[model samples]
Target: MATAYWKGANTKTGGGFWSSGHTPTLIAAFLYFDLAFMVWVLLGPLAPAISKALALTPAEKGFMVATPTLAGALLRVVNGLLVDRIGPKRSGAISQLIVIGGLLSAYLLGVDSFGGTIALGVILGFAGASFAIALPLASRWYPPDHQGKAMGVAGMGNSGTVLASLFAPGLAKLFGWNTVLGLACIPLAIVFVIYMAMAKDAPGRPAPKSLSEYLHPLKSADAWWLMGFYSVTFGGFVGLAASLPIYFTDRFGLTPITAGYCTAACVFAGSLVRPIGGALADSIGGIKMLIGVFIVAALALAAVSIAPTVGSALAFFVVAMLALGVGNGSVFQLVPQRFGAEIGVMTGLVGMAGGIGGFYLASSLGLAKQWTGSFAPGFLIFAALALVALVSVFVVKSQWRRSWGAAEGVRI
Candidate 1:
């Protein structure tokens, strides 16, 4: 059955992208991913109000937002394991329930302290871990030829962050940030129903691996390289997603709602381009797309460090986000090509790396602000990391092309 689906779905000519896979599952993945991402980064949009309410220090505000990223990064490995063992649909269902319950509980209990916010952030990590499940759930239904588009459609769920940025602040302004948490549950519950009804496990899942065997991919250097590259691209993209509101508010004295609007514009630019990035990678080669991604991201981040005006900084951020977003899609385009057999776990590992990158950037910016009285040092340092990633990808491209890239019969 799975073989027939695979062969039929490998539509290189007339069938087209939408016809190449299970559309219902793909749509379910996107919806799941979108809502999960909305709540996952919810703290970021609410950070200004939370900080003001709690009288949080700059570093505290940074850590409050960064906590979810770090926790999510770690949880992705666990979710990855679950996806392989129980299937992506089950994994996603379980994760969504946890997030909804956590948010509901937080809303009922009320978060009044910095510590309370950190706790809520940890709960939000499950939403962040949705990346591990949603991607594989959709990717497994499609063939190698359509990996980029399949993954891009599913992965585009990150656009949910834009939704949060757009609405959370305004809702908080009207009803208080704590109430915003409870209100978020309404849409989450609705999506939960839709996801349960729509999502289905793809057939022919790999036989469950032993615990030790699940970690087998780490033995290969290629896995590490992919993880490192994602940490920069996804890391930069998500890190900025969580921190931009704080940046706009602190630097420009914009109201929280206004800052969220600015953040939404930046995030929307990045989120909007992810599918294009994947498609570009599919056509040209993932390695080639990444080379350009790193260069543009690095330049934009460095430029952002010195932008003296809000308009200039927003412009730089949007450019940086666009590059990083494309890099996100390009990285995933290579993942299934190189690690198809282990896509579930690889998604977990790679997604974790991205989350850690976000954690680092979000936290470091806060520390930089507290210690140096400016966010410049943190931005410059991350910009340097992007360059390092660029050099590293360049160093490995030749060998990749000669090895797996050739074997896979896909543009790398």
Candidate 2:
């Protein structure tokens, strides 16, 4: 019975007030994550434009789009170390500067060919590393009961990708893609100034730990589980965000602007639902919420795999992305519960997994299209993995309730 599975799961422990003091850090983290996400996923909407300019084949397009995701995965570990050592504020500023420099170099110097775009994508990975910096930055300020709400608010910065999808193609049409890249640096520069001036590391933050201690969470099985779970949720959300422009254009013969609009709608659905997901998890249980999320997402993916109409396919994608967004929120809500002491490091480790998952999905869709001339196989494969997550959650939930959920001041 559902009741049996969720026994003691509804239990709440400590209650934390959302006083006005925590607002700036939360807003700063959101801005950092949002603008970074905008820049991180820029290549997706720009892929069609760059492909036309550079004469990139389908596989080349996929590789270019997926490069940032994979590169971000590797850089996340390094940023995680910096976040642990130098603090999120400093680490984040350094990362923002690197990303800004890279963008300026690309804009002024120019990307003349496919290889240049790939190199540019690598620099864009710094934007993606904001994931490692922002979550821990926000998590440190709030208490456990407010963990879900706070992280969810920060994670909404992912809606930045929506801005990219909405505007990148049109601006590229009007001003040239290079100019768009140059213009992107402006918002980032402003954000960096704001973030530096406003965001601060928590007082009484733990002393910098050794490399081994920073990675100690990896020694736990639960850490691996969280990584796996986030790999799917965040992976699906971002992978689709990066790929949907191409998918809409290829599948439906839509223009880049129209496709961007479609992609933006889907991204908006996912981004808008995230905070609701976190709040829901806070009330019932993340374990239970994730179970529903995996199931809904798997079903949605499977349905989209065979969808015959543009409207039908998009409808499924909206549902799947919504579920994935909820899953992203639920996973983090549980993270602070199990590893509050290690949230900084865990955010990077788990965030790396999410980036890797996104890389795989984005690349696989291209490969699937190149090799098989259809995207159904990729959707089917991921649906199977979602089911794997669903089953894994069933086994893990009972144990979590009896252990972490039973703790006096932690919400499971």
Candidate 3:
């Protein structure tokens, strides 16, 4: 029954959002992206149980969770290229198979050591790279006027992290962390089958570009700026998503399940706001919305660094996540406006930066806890990065206004 709705998405096109684009592909992209993300950050929610079983050190836990983010960051570039060359539907199919196989193998073999977890993380990176595939698959189907909302809805799949936070720890506690890996494959396989059935490449995909042509977006300073901006917005969001469980367990002495619940609240807030952010950016302007995002994010993170109680910390984290979540939407809203032609690769490039940012934050928090006996420094430094993004966006606004005419209801 569900399959029929998706199979029929092509016939629904008419006038507005539903009519203007392929709803089936958009829904497929979201489900694929959502499930991939759930497992991509799966290690984070499982970290407490994994750490306890392995007797891992603080730094080891951080590195373990962070490995997927770094691997995902690098693979996104590869997926971006694949999307342009082979089409997003095929690219997504291949990625899904890799992830499912990787998890199934990990489950069958069992991961007992730090090294094994690291290997598993690299496999999860394939899931993370789904970012590059999912966005373009949906984005190409929509007209420019609907880019923000369309991308926002598709991109909202990042909310999958909330699912991990909500479930993994309890499952790990029940069946053991290793079993959790195998269990994850069930949903992933289900989504993969649905994705294959529902996802269709949009018409008029760009001809395969030379490798150099794909990298051309890198030559532009605007591209660099966008990458940097996303690094902070998405970086903060995902970094905390992966790290907060560890933080709660370590700092607050919360049970793993409780920590997971707390982390879910934080992730859910960030995910929920993502589409609203894009819509707001469309109404105002990406630049204007981003400027406010950076300011709020900076303040919130700074406050979090000094939060003394779990309640206070949760409040600060929620505020920071909200600002960062909105920033994620706003960044993409601008990405299509400026680089619509290169959206495929640009998504990879900017997404890579965001992943790198997540890697740094997640890893550094562990290092900070190990070295300084507090996670405060890591939070402070990232708070500083948010301020830097604020400045970068402010400086570029005038240039963007001069270059991009007021067209398509997308404010620069």
Pick the TM-score winner. 1
lDDT of 3: 0.90
Per-residue CA lDDT of candidate 1, range 91-207, in tens?
A: 999999999999999999999898899999999999999999999999988887778888988999989999999999999999999999999999999998999999988877778
Candidate 3 per-residue C-alpha lDDT over 159-248 given as tens digits, one digit per residue, 9 for 90 to 100: 999999999999988898899989999999899889999999877677687999989988889999999999999999999999999999
RMSD values, in order shown? 2.1, 4.6, 4.4
Rank list by lDDT: 1, 3, 2
Q: Candidates ranked by TM-score, best first?
A: 1, 3, 2
* Count of clashing pairs, candidate 3: 1
lDDT of each: 0.92, 0.87, 0.90
Q: Who is ahead in lDDT, 1 or 2?
A: 1
Model 2: runs farther than 4 Å from truth?
A: 1-17
The most accurate candidate by lDDT is 1
